[model samples]
Target: MVDVAQHIRIFDQKPADELVPKRTAAIKDLASKLTGPKDVDGLMKMASNLVAAAKFDKKLPEELAQEATASIKKQSPAFVREGRDLELSTIALLAMLGAIDGGTKQGIIERLNFLSAGVWLGLSFQQPNKESRIEALRVEVLHAARDYVARGAENARERKAPALGAPLKPENTNLGEVVSNLRASVERLNRNAVVDREEIDFLWWSVTKWSSALDGLYDEASAYSAAIAFGLDGGARLRRMPLDVHKHLVLRRIRAAEPVSLAGLIAAVGDDRLRILTKIPDASTARTNPEIFPVMSSLLSGSAPKSASKDLQSVEAWTVRALLEATALGLINQHEV
Candidate 1:
């Protein structure tokens, strides 16, 4: 199994106000440790610890996050030489920091490319294994789709639309006539190949989300937060995650709404095959109009709201709840922002 970062359990029971002073001291201590090492092994271990700590605290200093992001990117080559495990670890670090730093779309894509390579290599080591082969095929399809789009963009650039002589009727017109048509086609294809525009928009929105909470732009924090949630579920041990932070963000919002029973919440979330949790008609109607999907609606809305003090104090609930609290902190940071 892949060794993924674990969310730090410290201060899990503390209120937001009480957590502040502890978080400040912890960051200060971690920052001090960072000053001691520049070696690859040391850096990897330190980064893992830093990420775990990050999962615990939402409002880490922007300058510190930026510094951590740069260090991880710079050390990518060394990590690659180490092995697949380390490379994956490095990618995780970059993904977390990139989101936190509100890094450019190009930066996130670069880390994703590394992730694809690492996953492919890991699967290669397990070749001839039944499960690995099945998983490899899925990765192959994504790669093919990516490549096809890239090729289409290149072809469009190379083969300009046939020049029409003089002014021609609309039926005879080519893409070049509109000026923006060819450019738009190439851009669209490139975007499809490289990344989705909606996701890029979400990344920026997450930056805004974090920035508003921090009283300054701390972009990509939700990306990191999503990663934290995924890691908690040990999803890293299974396969690569699609870069869709919005679904996870919506899940955080559902959690923010505060359900009474943790087990029931997970069960309701499990039935979301088409991701109805993120959609309104399917999930919300359970609250407003419970007859639509009785099983889901009932399970989702059955329990009355419980006070934070009344909620379960188990590790699983605490960590999941903390993610909600961390995200909600940004939403309410106005007078506090």
Candidate 2:
């Protein structure tokens, strides 16, 4: 009586008519089997057992089946297939892996929250809440994504996203307050000379815009390097470029604060994949997202100049100059990871 095939279609959002009885029967069958407490642990078990049995009986592929098995160890393989596409499957896989590997429910929740931040960021851009803070973040992400897309050789049709960067000061953008990201974009414009602005003050501001964007670039570059400095081996994809990422990061961090070692950076940020780890926070005192990605992207875009090199000489140059400001504040400290 359980119309399993019809139920799959219904859950998957496939159009199905004339299967009311069948769908009802399938739902009843599922309800009958689920008789215990409906907590996360129980839910996980229920889904995992069902998916694991399917895997063994159906003999899924090594990679997929392996993921299925790992999911079973935590809660359920149903999660993998339940998602609309591979993206959700990827998220589910990570979640299940975390659950199995002794990650607490709280930790799992945090990871899940982290995953959802991008969604919220996108939504915030589309329709920000009353709070100007939310609007601020929306602008940052839109600006970042737009600038990155503009730099790529992709078509305008493929690259067009909604305009998101609101002027921090619509009436008057103080030279000191220009976001590093926008500054970099403007600089790229100047370097490329896409069009020349006649106004000298405007041109000067544009130069500054590019400079701030460079800072963002260095922020991200350093974060990625920080991840490398930590133990990320062949994990996240590296940028397709000729930039000396590590040296760039080292220099950038030194500039941000005084001369912190690789260990010190690891201490401050906790990882090098500043590119990914760098998230836009809720504008607390702490800078949440790694400061390097926006900056690195800017510096690397639109025929920008390259990094100094991978040599210690370049590293030393960064340490002395960039970190000079941080040293004044006593923020930089040498320590081991």
Candidate 3:
């Protein structure tokens, strides 16, 4: 396997402060050589050469220099291509300078890989066929949201435990800011109405659901690991799970006359039972958990409760109604009886 950590360090660690000017000058000299679009290939070659020069001039390790050269070769094409419309060339040059200065050559390359994919994917979805384009973008948005949520949950798990003398600080993942940014993006996208409204709505709803789930997980220490595992598993499942299966899940919730909040659903099944349902069972253990299986089956199959307290019932009703609206809006598909 590629040594990702080593690669990350190639760009992440900053160079000596006094050497910064020399690094900047070197990058600028290379950038100045690119006269036009046709010069992109030559410019990439020049960047590789610069890396080689830096190994000796800056006393950088030979391995780091080689990795940096590889990164420039791999990421320079995309930067050059995008530079046609935007100041991507300048941006790329500046990034390269920073990578060299910071010794994060591999990190810069990996980041550029993601950036290149995003740029091309965005352009692809901006085609004339609006319906198909919107659908494609929706899938991308879903995957992005899932990845963000799972990564956030995982990070929360890895947070260091406070010392005995220290007060235990709450886990602060900066999730609120992230959610705010997502909402702003959704609002901006909605203003032009370039994409399907239903697709945008679904994206917005997913963001809210994820934010709420993360908040709940952050507050409950005992449930954190289980919830994070469930979320990560669900995100993985979403990628390959059939569209029909998702429709079925949504349809089951929609069929309930009363609302069914996620909390209510959890309560009905019990947390331990819900946790078991989310878990992947080994072949030997799968059939042995007969009682646990029925709980999951019943939770999915049962209608909304009629006799719950007014407050709980209200929450349930709101939840179910939201699903109904989502189905009607085509955010969630309603399966025919």
The lDDT values for all models are: 0.32, 0.29, 0.31
> TM-score of the candidate numbered 2?
0.18
TM-score of 3: 0.18
Positional deviation of residue 82's Cα in model 1 after best superposition, in angstroms: 24
Top model by lDDT, which number? 1
What CA root-mean-square deviation does each model show from the true structure? 21.1, 20.2, 23.6
Indicate which candidate wins on TM-score.
1
Candidate 1 vs candidate 3: the TM-score winner is 1
Q: Would you estimate the TM-scores of all the predictions?
A: 0.21, 0.18, 0.18
Q: Model 1 over residues 92-120: C-alpha lDDT tens digits? A: 33333323232122322233222222222
What's the residue-level lDDT of 22 in candidate 1? 37
Tens digit per residue, CA lDDT, model 2, 267-312: 4443332332232111111121112221222212311123312222
User: Which residue pairs overlap in candidate 1's backbone?
Assistant: 99-220, 102-219, 207-219, 333-337
Ranking 2 against 3 by lDDT, winner: 3
Question: What lDDT does candidate 1 reach at residue 320?
Answer: 36
Give the lDDT of residue 150 in candidate 3: 33
On lDDT, the stronger of 1 and 3 is 1
- How do the candidates rank by lDDT, highest first? 1, 3, 2
Candidate 1 matches the true fold with a TM-score of: 0.21
